[model samples]
Target: MTLSIDNLQQMEIEYIKMFSEVSEDEQTLTFNNSNIPDMYTHNFDLYKSDVGLLEYIESQINKVETKAKGFFRIETYHPISADLIEKLSVKPQICTYDFMGIETRNYINLIGNPECSVLSAESSRVLEDGITVDIAVNEEGMGLDFATRRIKGKAEVYKNPDKAIELFVCYSGDTPIGNIEYIPFNRVAKFEDFDILEDYQRRSFGTSVLKHLLEKAFDNNIEHAYLITDQADTAKEMYKKNGFEKVGEKTELLFLF
Candidate 1:
């Protein structure tokens, strides 16, 4: 299968549509997940950067803010122009996400730790231990207070049987050390929300979980697997080392009220 920027973008949109209430217009696609009011799950995704569409994006965001609490975000497939940036009332923190993909055929024999085991999570409730541990270890200051709301919101969408999503918890011995989400569509699989506890980092647990995900993809005859990571994140290097390559990038504009 040939990997292209268009294919990566479409795959991402399909993944979002799985759990989000998506509404499309000529200018943008609005994704609203009332279940999870997180910035990523709820946003206005512009098909292209156009100064004329700025007002419509702002109006939609305003509508979302009134119904859903917390921050609002806008994603652009193309880079925002100076005119669009300068017109915003509040200066937004712009973020760039690199879309990475790989042909699983090239890595069918990849290996990792034999002791690390990946198990499918039947429900989000079962992921609490791993989520709690991961948050407590990775986040600063914010602990269970943050985890509670996040888990509650995620639980709404995680358990939906209609979605092609699968949640997995990685265990080392009897301890839950990490977790990841897998979504496969039309022979293309997406891996997201991958995290390992601080104490579990540097060991082979993270790699083992990734290897397990790829092996699952291969078993299902999936030709490609992909993930999105912040441009500054170090994890992209690890992904590249395995089999993934940078295929494209998307820009996110975030506004906090």
Candidate 2:
């Protein structure tokens, strides 16, 4: 079987639906009023070019972002269309990023050479009450101190919110070190919200987190594991070495409000 732009767009939809509040009809995906630093949490997904795209952008600019900035992912089969860019010049902009969508289905021999031993995250425990993520990082370095504490405080908020998301935190004993979030849409696992304690980097934490997460995916009979990463050399090398092959690319439009 082959992947389509629609399938990947829905996965993008699933990504937003997991966190903040969203309402979608046929053409536009609206993430209404989520004040999270995470881009996925507060953004819109335009299926294709249409008048509705302009309307949605205008509406979001006035009612939503004001002078903040308009950052969004516009999923397309190929690179973005020039027609789309011309339509988006209504506002001043900063830059755009095209993410290479990577995937791996049938498991191959595990890939990668780590300087340290590879270890798996603890296990699948509920994000609500059963298991808690308590990764301890330098309060100043990566700002994990704020994010970790905030999410931990809002742990039960998911129950009242709309979607189901799986969050797994890795530990180096009683102290938590790293974590990953997987949102499964139709059999594809979308992995993001990854963080390792500042002091724990380059020590196989990333390798271990991804290894265990994919192992869980395989165990659950998942067909595809999808990742959207920047085109940076280091980011590409790390995931490529971990068996994630560059499959498709996603492009986004950026405008400075």
Candidate 3:
């Protein structure tokens, strides 16, 4: 059985909320990074309908083990009986164990706040950089209202706010052009880590702003930072220039039965 994108998205949303709830007690449980994009489950029936979802989970668990650090183990919880299984024992894949699986997915890389040097010379050299931007942290209702118009002309993705800190940025003229939506991760213990997005990409505006943000993160006592980028994106080099190392990977898997 194949799941529609809408159904997949809905499942993801539910899982995000579930992870958020889990984070309330244990701050380490979040679903925004690498292979576990946002697989939330409000209705187990949806997953049950798909015979191969369990295999997908198993593959993801193995993949995560190879690519990420900090988590000791992954488990699946059955809501009704409060039963937890360390490894999904079901075999949804019909084939024999004759081949290995490889895939990729969209995810955000997280890092603890850490101090690092980013070349401010690039932003200063860009004569097109003319806007004065100011970022406001966690003042959602009003700040978003003030920043929405600026964001209208740009790109954005919202992380799970409950497990992470929320940020809102505005310009001096009440026009916001860029934003960084992120969560608090303690793994990269020396860096105040975040994912940055800008409405405009030409002038190194977003990169410049991110440099400042990292500076602030360092001031707050952070050491390392990480972010997940599409394999096609060249900006990975920028992250490297700023002192982040590629510590893990996430792949997407599609299941059809």
Q: Which candidate is the best by lDDT?
A: 1
Error of 2 at 240 (Å): 0.4
Candidate 2 TM-score to native: 0.67
1 against 3, candidate with superior lDDT: 1
Runs in model 3 deviating more than 4 A are: 1-163, 170-174, 187-199
Q: Which ten residues in a row have the lowest lDDT in candidate 1?
A: 41-50
Model 1 lDDT, full chain set: 0.74
Q: Candidate 3 on 1-257: residue-level lDDT in tens?
A: 22233333333334345333333222123333322322212111122222343454555445554235322222221121212223444322221111111111101232322322222211322111111232232225336544443322121122233434334341323334444433334422111212233444434554454555555555654444344454555666655544554443333322222
TM-score-wise, the better of 1 and 3 is 1
lDDT of 2 by residue, 66-86 (tens): 445545433333454466556
Deviating ranges (above 4 Å) for candidate 1? 38-40, 48-70, 123-130, 133-143
- For each candidate in turn, the TM-score is 0.85, 0.67, 0.38
- Candidates' C-alpha lDDT: 0.74, 0.55, 0.33
**Could you tell me how far off, in angstroms, the CA of residue 8 lies in candidate 1 after the best superposition?**
2.4
Scanning candidate 3 in windows of ten residues, the lowest lDDT window is 97-106
Model 1 steric clash pairs: none
Ordering by lDDT:
1, 2, 3
